[model samples]
Target: MPPLNSTNNTESENVYNCPPIKHVPFPRSTSYYLQSEITDEFLQFAFSFLAASFQFLHLYRTVWWLPDTHMHQTVNFHLIDKSVALFLLILLSRRFWYSICITCVDLMVTKKRLYRMRLVLRYVFFFVITILLGICCVDIYFKHNNRVVYMCYPIIVYVIIFHFNIEPFLRTVYEGDMIYINGSPLHCCSTNPSAIRTEIDSLKKDFNNRFKQVIFTTLFNAYYGSVIPCFFVQNFVFYDIWITTFHMAFVLVGGFTTSTMFCLPANYCDVMHRAALHLGGWTRIDHRVASPATPWSKTTVWPNGSVVKYSGDFYRSHGLTTTAIPSNSYDNKFYMFFQNPAHIYTILSLIQVVIIVTQLFVLYFATEWHQMLSLGFLVLCNYFTLFKMIRDFFLTQRIYESESNIYARNLSN
Candidate 1:
């Protein structure tokens, strides 16, 4: 370890109170500050749960209660249902309020206690939402009517998907590889730079592993992908037009927003990996493509003036190598060994396109209220998916550009 000094003390202090890193820029230029103030995981969880609630709760109401009629006998019943719904809406709104308050706290307070509290609140809410969803499923199934059964069949499946995998889901998203990898605690804010780097490496591994799980479970898994659309379709014939509209709109909007989060981990990993490689001067170069004379070969030059061309023989013999110079020692010994999720993303996009096309056709011929709900949902999902895809493209481009600049500057030096 390096000798302790004023510089080392200051570095330790910085780690103790350092604000969480912000990777993705918000759409609004002004919101960049806001993004730093609030944790993305909390924000995304709040939005996803709120959206799921809109679908789950509204379906619950329609499943359990008959439509409101202004008759003397049923007036009280209608009032009770409406009151309960209003209360749930306020409850959901509180999550957004909590997120804003957490942002404020993050800005003004850097206490370890406060940070722990924030994590607690986050887990508490996640648990609450999971339980609430379970309650909704149980309530619907107990009704024992054909209409109720039909309306909640999709929900039952949704509940099952979440229920079974929720443990791994929670581990992957919130904990990542940060927790319980070993018996000892690995502090993210360590006095030793290598320790910190180790923590970050674990974090990157968590991102890759978590994303792989999400892509498999939610996107490409056996039946979960199809079930997402079914969530929009089940309430069609059972609920009143207005109720169906509210439920459908909320589900569609909520789902679209939440689904974007699934892509976040992969995007973050991509940026971080590239950034590490560029900073380390280990980025693979394609000299073969750069020259007209040798238009089809790839080659990379080392900082020490060693030149090597790409070939099966070369790779087998030499394997991968990193720069001898250690400029940014804070970044853990990173390796660009992981495969990019770009192909997985492409396959997901193709699947989404097919689903959207099929859904659109269903909507075009849909004459009923429920069918219209499904249609509205698919349209919203498509819009959001396209928007997210475009945004990711730009984000990736920006990261690559940043990497290129870093490489160029290092090369010049």
Candidate 2:
């Protein structure tokens, strides 16, 4: 807007191809790097689909073809494995070509093209999985018996032995963990109560000085989001709390979008930040938290799939990270705001949270056993909400830093 030469040097250098935070480190497994060959949506989905198919394929062979063959390796299953591997190889090749396309083309060209390709791929796989899950969900989708507990397809999608066949595939492409709402989770996880409590009372306070908070933000969300629903199902006794809360689709697209009321400021300090200086102030902030230092600075090895290279500086104008270098964000945005899904998830979550919270309170007086259930659910719910809030707040901080980078580039030119 200015002469395009206006820049913020200090923030600029830190944003582009920047070093990892010396203090805070997050899970390398979750984020998608724009520059990484494997991180491309096509490549990722290819692998996920293949992985999913391989799972059920082998399962088919073992259960149907070689049920009683107690051997280390069997011809039937191996054949199935080989077939899947071949398919995987082909798909990977397809993605490899696409990744190359992203590498050489201008971002404007690349993004436009790649975005379409990704949408096509997203729907294709989602449809396939949905078809397979629809059968199971139909069997389970039921009304709550005046009891606050309930289950949905998203919850059961990855919940069984059959889940083994789907989970790896689902988890591989799922980067939606960090972007949770105050009530409903954007993504899903499998956890229990004891696990739920871990993130709540101890996390923020313990993580006050560590930006590792971001890394573990999803961890806590998963830990508790999953755990809370689990407690609801188990009645909170010495019961086995099998959890499958989070709405994967929401996670895939977007769950809920709380008001910018709690958005954090761009700078890392103990003061309230502007809800959004860029997005027409639809968001706002009052309290401020210090920039938790990035943890996981140890020189640790990462999965081959996690290594992504993006010149974050290039995307500064779009309000993305430049100083942070590209890392994993369990919060996947590609499938959400950019696509047709938009913020339907935000509205869904708000509705879900209100409904669930009220129903939960009503259940409080319904039965004492459920009262125990409510206690557990309460702990898990609050904890996950906190985790989601933390994720959203810090994510905004990142956006601001990225904006700063773009602001600098505009100035220099």
Candidate 3:
């Protein structure tokens, strides 16, 4: 089959007529469109549970069983804690990195001299931070308690704060520009075929670049966050070895889910959907056109084929001139459950709640004030995550339900 970039109308017609890509069949009850997402969500939940359990076990053993002097002599808990915190911040700030890169690209194209200076300064800053973090890890490995290593702690904290604050400004600046993958620039109704093809290709490249960056960074963080911290513990006994092994194992699983099953499929779908919108909706393109871009190991074609459904209001909001694609009548329970952002957030909220409760229970039994403080920090982090999940859940549910009601009313009319 010709690639999606084919410009000739006859060639496009031939592409559309090609048979749908075949795949191994799934159970009839499950919608193929949702299979990967649903599976990924469940795997994410399992990974979260395992990681939280292992973290609690680690905290308990270190605080209650190990002799205080031996613990202090054998490991620098302060260094390990800070290093782990930095890694966690890195993992959580993937979107921030994505936005920054896009902003840099925009600056390069629109303001060349400014972009050059910003790029050089940013690289230098990143290099310095990386070296400092590396020095901290080296100190941890050799069990040295250098005061200078503490510097990275505050720097990482500042970066995380800056990420949260700057991301909104970046989004506002590039709200409807095609320079970023998420940008929703509306096309004229009579857009040229070549321009549409070019835009699709550009978007695909952006998605690929963003996806690779996420995978690389997640793996990097997993190494620092999960593996390096284990080195701080002496691992002298069977219990120590077991704890270290399980903790590392759980983190590896979590990293895999985060990189492949969770982020990959979701990002792939969103980019493809956005591409479909650019082409004036799913009806204009052949399903086969998107098959090549999907993460084939995790996804399959919908048995009855899938559709992109949005209302005219969605188009207007995005400043699109194209007509809205109608909803499919065959949308199944699995499709609804997986596609609804609220449902995903609800699952995350439940997981966060369980983790918080577990941490609090462990904290109650702790004798050491330092251990209590450590547990308190973890509890606070989980609480924050839970709050975001709950807020998103309600907001998404309201929007989606309102859209559904509007669609229903329009159908009845």
Per-residue CA lDDT of model 1 for 34-153, tens digit only, reads 233134444444444444443433343432233664343411233222322332443334434555655566667668678686677666766776576556545544543332343334
- The parts of candidate 3 lying over 4 Å away from their true place are 1-112, 126-177, 180-219, 232-339, 357-371, 411-413
- List clashing residue pairs in candidate 3: none
Residue 175 of candidate 1: its Cα lDDT? Answer: 41
For model 3, give the RMSD to the true fold.
14.3
Encode model 2's per-residue lDDT on 275-337: one tens digit a residue: 111110111111132122122111211111122223221111122111111232311222123
Cα error of candidate 1 at position 296, Å: 28
Runs in model 2 lying further than 4 Å from the true structure: 1-38, 41-50, 61-70, 78-93, 101-393, 397-413
Report the C-alpha displacement of residue 130, candidate 3, in angstroms.
5.8
Provide TM-scores for the models: 0.45, 0.23, 0.43
On residues 58-141, what C-alpha lDDT tens digit does candidate 3 reach at each position? 543443345554563322344335544454444334334544555566556656476576556456545654675576566544
lDDT of 1: 0.40
**CA RMSD (A), model 2:** 21.2
**By lDDT, is 1 or 2 better?**
1
Better of 2 and 3 by lDDT: 3
